[model samples]
Target: MLTALNNPRPAMLAVFMLLGGSVAAAASPTITVSWRDKPPYHYLDNGVPKGFLLERTQAIFAAAGIATRLAPEPQKRIWANFSHGATNYCSFSWYRLPEREAVGQYTLPISIDPPHSVLVSGAALARVKTHATLAALLADQELTLGVVDGVSYGPELDAMIAHSANQMMRRTVDTTSMMRMLSVGRASIMLVDREDWEYVHRHEPILQSTTRLDFPDMPPGLKRYIVCSRDISPLVMDKINQAITATGGAVRSSHGTEEERKAHQRP
Candidate 1:
């Protein structure tokens, strides 16, 4: 099934009876909440949707007293819908990108990822260890970098990749395929989010012949947001932002600078 229904009746009743403000009407058009099949973040378990981000998104909508329909969609399809200005649609956990800003409206960050790590094949591990920074490794023309098509490694790394002269192996595949490619030495190295690396490392055996490496020049963790199409009202966005704040979601401060965010994040 492409869509899963969320029963908002009980929550709606509670909102009307106890929370008692002019929350969105229960009869409002149902917003479609779309997600890709990225496990530990969002995926279907026995036809029932489950994941940290999925649950948080449901909670936010429930708190906002808006009706929503959960839908599992391909990553490319989700972005394509936004580009075409699909109405009443929202997707969770996307990095804020410049080009994407023109297509969709973004809510406050709903989650954050740890810094990206490089997955190096056993054959390339020795060579990978020679580079002190990510820039040097990307400068190596002989080392082929495997990248997932249509995915961004955040603004900083995306900029690096665009300017690098390294041989690139772009695949329209998932992380598992990329990992398998590395294990078989088809690609020398690939960058993966630390969260994704941990999840795949536990559930898949492809990492047996690959090693995860970190570099000092790796960009700071990227903040993920719930992006909705243009038709979603500003009023609704304010409600969503309020719900995010209530659920302990983090937002960039007025200055909106990474340096300030990093300083505040320091332990």
Candidate 2:
């Protein structure tokens, strides 16, 4: 007859289904994954989210059997969310900074960025080229260095820039705007990410008048990881790390054309 107490399985199943949908739905907790607007990496395209890193992140969560809601937020808001210990919140593709460690737990590397290069205006190229190494160029107090406020040029460069004697002009702007500033000679030079340089160079004619110089003193590319608030569970982080191992972290070709992007997708 399978009375209520004798056979609680059916009742439990019904309650589970009623509460959520199925066992899977109840077991899988959904988290909000946030990212800043850094195109060809992670950004909004005409209101729809797009980016190789975003796609790769989606794939990692799916492979880990986790549920995620993609959220595009400003850089400041993203950090603020982590600082306040927002439950089940995560941000993608950030450098594993020492100061940031206090706010969030980092998963295994999610992406790797190529080393930074110097973007010099035509008026500054000759002076910039005179220096044999990045150190020498940064030490030049005569040159004004344009930096994006609150951004890291990776650990090595960040340290160098902090101690550099050069004149500084810092702004809170995107790479495109920074490139424009360089074109107008607002600053003599700026450190640029290789991927950002490629994307901006193709779209901005101003780059044609500028130069991208790589230096021997430049550090190797930096590895980026998915950082989550303290409230996110260890189980979830383990799954993410396993997924990162299964799929070689998300560094894909950043130079794909729009047609190619439309044709290709990760399986």
Candidate 3:
């Protein structure tokens, strides 16, 4: 070994580091992945990726002899990197939106959630109590709706929001903040997954009195999927498809815990 005094040149050190990385990667070339923090599905647990979706996804990839490494990052960066082909990563717990599908490859359905549920404070609910359906509720312009900015609430809901964009209040953040808007009546109503609403409600006392509005006209629960960068090789995706088939399906279990179904009720 060279003595401590005999330092390597910077250029040589960089080349050596590059060679070391290549050698290490050849033995185990893991795909780096990440997704936004959407609770009860995917999120970072103590700075490490630890959701049920991660476990299920990892299991499928592992069984296919493919490994993955987590690169926790913001949601926007996930798409940006993929779009530029700067990196190859797959996002979890995504929904099938035509706009997104045009830009990336999507995996099979990850989970079938109940229809996006509308939420309103107890008092707000009473105002629209007679309006029992989505159409009727939308006709009443007195109440403003809340939504997370840039989120696609399914095609049908997206159309609805577009129709009432003037009456819609959007937050440039997660649904948790939108829920808060409903709690204080700053926003009269909001749309979210029943499971997601309940999860956030449990933690935010301001939302304790929130009620789910019944919308018979709404489509069935949204189908969650993983939208991968278009640049990902077909072989890797084919393997994932086979893994999905082998694992039965990606919607194996809810991820609030190892046994979330037993722990939380279907809302």
Backbone clashes per model, in order? Answer: 0, 0, 0
Question: Which stretch of 10 consecutive residues in model 2 shows the poorest summed lDDT?
Answer: 258-267
TM-score to native of every candidate shown: 0.84, 0.84, 0.79
Candidate achieving the largest TM-score: 2
Candidate 1 vs candidate 2, TM-score winner: 2
Query: Candidate 3 has which clashing residue pairs, if any?
Result: none
Q: List model 2 lDDT by residue over 1-267, tens digit each.
A: 458689999889889777774466457768999999887788887899988888899999888878899989888889988887799898898998998999999999987776677888989988887898889999999999999987887888888989999999999988778989998999999998767777777877877888777787789888888999897778779989999889886564453466643332111
Tally clashes: model 1: 0
Candidate 1: where is the Cα deviation over 4 Å? 1-24, 251-267
In order, candidate lDDTs are 0.83, 0.83, 0.72
Give me the displacement of residue 225 in model 3, in angstroms. 1.5
Structure candidate 2, residue pairs in collision:
none
lDDT of 3 by residue, 32-69 (tens): 77777776566665876676666777777766666677
TM-score of 1: 0.84
Predicted structure 1: lDDT: 0.83
2 or 3: which has the higher TM-score? 2
Pick out the ten consecutive residues of candidate 3 with the lowest summed lDDT: 258-267
RMSD of candidates 1 onward, in order: 9.9, 7.1, 10.1
Query: Could you arrange the candidates by TM-score from highest to lowest?
Result: 2, 1, 3
